[model samples]
Target: MPAGYSLHDFSFDLRQHMAPANVWVTSGWTSVVAAPGTVCGVGGCFAPPYAAPDSSLSVTLEVDGRELRDGVRAGIAGFGLGLLTSGGTWRPDRIERSGTFHQYDDGRLVSLGVHSRLTPVHGAGGYVLEITVENRADRDAEISIHPRLSAGQPGRLPLADWGWMAPRAGDLVAAASTSMTLRHDLLHSRVPAGGRTRFTLAVELGEAVEPGEAARPGATEPDPADRARQATDRWARRLATALDAFPRLETDIPGLAAYWHRSIASGLVCLWDNPGFVTTPFVATSGVDGGALCAYVWDTGGYAPHLLTLMLGETATDLLEAMLKADLTKHYAIAPDGTGLGVAYAYSGWSLVTLATAVASQRGLARGLVERLHDAVAALDARFPAVGELRDYGTQHNLLEMRGAGWEHVVASPNAERAAYLDALATLAEASGAVLPVDALRATAHRIRASIADELWDAEAKWFRSRYPDGHTELTYSVQAFDALRAGACTPQMAADLIARVRPGAFLGAYGVSSVSAEDERHYELGDTDWSGGGAYTGEAPQLALTLWERGEAELAWTVLSRLLWMGEHYPYFPQEHYSDRPAAPPVGRRANIIAGLAGAEAILLGLVGVRPRPDGGLVISPPPAPGNVALRGLRFRGRSIDVECTPHGFSVTVDGRRIAPEGGAVVVPAA
Candidate 1:
């Protein structure tokens, strides 16, 4: 079998690779695990309440009469096998015992390369592992490949017992607990003197109703090579579709272009569509290795808007629907066990609005879904006290309570977000032609907005401050104010003041925008990994950048975006947050944060590309007036795909392959 190409650079330095130790490839229901030293397995095989240990595959490789039980592990251990990259070399003999692992450059190598992929088939899915090896010495190399699954350990019951799998020819059958089966195929060939050879191991995991029922619907029994080709084609189409939706950056900077492509691909990987589980198709904030296997309402909400930019409307819908179906009263995070919702911060309203925006943009939300959403929002609204003369209820700090701001009692950020949610509900009701309390929602939103401008805005501080429940106001510069600004609660002058305060020495940091002004003594303080005192949260960076972009601070917006992307160069995964200080601490959470990826994607599509979806099934696009060339193609809006090209001279828009006159032909940057 020929080696399959990698969608992204899955190859990392050997030392850092074991930190997570597992590489996950998922086609919704089926999750394939590819670990460096150990064999691969299927994750989440058993249903909810039963923690099923993955069915592990162990491998043995024979080269030149030498039997290798674990080629990768042996190679890292410096047993005649060596790992080489362009910049650094790693051998067992020269292993360093101190500090960080030797960082290897990302490029080609003559020795070996391991690539893994998750591909969907008609009824089942295939996890393909392609290993390519080249003989640099002058000798013919004979290779033998062995792949088998060992019975899981006893005593752990449902999760530990690997069940019972009877191997027949090329297939493995499990009949004990759950009706599951997998077909495995190994393909390999000999390598001539100084020649290269590719080995492929394909495993097909699918559901079986009875003892010997035919393969599940859409499952196919194909050759390992054919399976790999199909999976490769599917992933290519997905990446192409996603890339067409945003501006293709033309830059001389290294890794910038790869970042754009990887960002979209990584975001899609984190979105799971498992039909086997209760929440069959929900987006996991972090993939399996990220340690966050469930969905958080706030994180999913943040992910929805960005997911829309990738033309993943169906996926975004599934996630929002799952959230609505879960216990809305305690809607905080969805447990991995699929049992009940976990309550933390009372910020479901914010997530609801994001879901509404994504649904409204699709222009095809079912009336039933809209009505259900309306009821949920109404229930959420009832939890808040009425919008009285002072609108104190609207100013409650319920939104940022999880971020260590609960002591503030009342805050403008949640009020602004509440106002935004009400506006979204009204818009969604009108768009779906549903008989919702649009008038009442609009009135409440208006009251909340009025209160934010009047009660939260401190004239002397020139910032939106929190008004204590005791009738006292606390003046603290916070990045949370950007949320209110995004909701349009601030006037023109007020917005300007906030923007000026976010300049480089204040809230802006090298990694991203800080949660609090640098001048604040508590800016560098850390609290429970939340955005309390201060931290550069990747999820919030794009929000602030987008706000600045909308306010015509194009240059500043791009600066903020550049900083966020800069972190991607250093961190292998999309970090959740970082310290505000220079040379910030290592990123928090797993390498992949769905919220951050989505937000970064949105910053490119909505902020820099200046494309906004209108409730009336139209698009409002206004690309920033920056001195760079960008061509945005394949942008889907309200069932119509549009292409946009922007240059220093002007810009052009084409709707569904036909050119249409834009409201504004070209954006001219004002002289500083």
Candidate 2:
């Protein structure tokens, strides 16, 4: 592990947080959450009030027998968190925490100054707790620590999950223990005046099972301590690799580096590799929030680079190739059986463009993939032979409720996104040998851009208002305008002009950029649906930051990133969207999708360490000014692995050990 990107660097403490709150970690196939007690499942965790004795599904911690000194509850089914002994019944008088690890003072646990500590470890399919107790009195003392589990019932699975897919047979979950120095699940040791004892307790959530078989452990089971060490190291490396795998910001900015690491790490936990789904590695949330129960284009844009990098060979190529087959304009989400699941939003093509950008960033416009992209674009164009420009079905279906502009007008989002798609289509045709009418595609895209930039730019309000069929601009400041910027809908001066109006009492909120500007109270609201107003859709704010960074407003971009970083710090995993004035989701119906929250990582990846893959088969390296010495290493672009090293001294790039020359104000690494 390098100095900054070590295992402990990602550690955080939730002990003082409200009980039952969780911070989840995953192995892609398996997942677990840290709550009052270790919970293995989607969202079936609660504080105290445990189950009856020997319950089929529960996490238990038993110490001593009955009351210790006076009357501290112990050895009881569904215990109340305490231990009893001779001198004085022990309780947690004072507890301290450092990065998920916990410590307790002496004399509060038992007669002989019983001091204790807890260290948490995450395994491939489970989480482990290593509990240690020490005695400091003159005489010897006896201690017993029993970590018990009773999982898997007759029909019901112990580990509960938010049903992302239709229920299948053999939803089995298991539990394992490595009681190295214990008898019958009990760890007993006589602690001398200055002696100590330790043991490990672990629980696991397995992968999807076959009808008649049990679930399988995700990885090879190692000894408890080795498992802990190895898991920690792997996670550290994964986080560090994400820095290089995607784009990483090398800065000492307070909260920036840690925020970036966690932003990328959130993607790891959000991924659930259930074999039953249409896609093996699903982008659905692991019962957190955001209701992302299936693979989504919106999510693929944010986390795909890290996953794509891990699958650097055929698997990577195959996955990116599949994006062309995805019906981005069809459904908001698809089911496990490959059928549409959610709304067929009008601007759902935004999802396609989002994923398209991700694909471009990872693989560039490589020849073979460009051929596939050409076919996909041709088929997409085939749908609009008579519809003139284009318009998807469903009104006000961009993200959620849109009362402004009747939610059914000639909007800017889908137009901007379509222009992006068509623009990419033309560029892809030019880059590869694929034959297509590039001139027509470019002309159509330009016409759309011209229409938006000409009619939609509200000179009076300094915002791109949604336009209606009546040729009038809608009154409101929407975050979707930011989307237009992402799709190259705004000229440089126009982009600056639009961004200049984003401030405290307008589009910018205390948390991040609001879905609807502050003063637009008629349309702005703290509702459940995404961007359903008055709040920051956790994902869009990152896009805003990335857009700002692209426009050379690094400071403003950092402003937005830092505001959302506060959410990541407060909530271990970022939620879908939150209110501007508070750290909470909308008041109405809500769901969890760490995938949306994970977009924060994309801002870090593409913004600070900006490495964009252009549609013309070239990779662009144009990062924001670094306040310190840092580097983005091992970036796999256009089928070639490259490194971007930057410091206060000078920034440079190397492709396969050959230093490359900077061209046109940025380094353009040509396809190998």
lDDT (tens digit, per residue) of candidate 2 on 246-277: 44346656666656665655555554434544
Error of 2 at 615 (Å): 3.6
Candidate 2 lDDT (Cα, 0 to 1):
0.51
Clashes within 3 Å, all models in order: 9, 12
TM-score of each: 0.75, 0.74
Against the true structure, candidate 1 reaches a TM-score of 0.75
Name the top TM-score candidate: 1
lDDT of each: 0.54, 0.51
lDDT of 1 by residue, 96-135 (tens): 1111112122332223332223343322433555545555
Roughly what TM-score does model 2 have, to 2 decimal places? Answer: 0.74
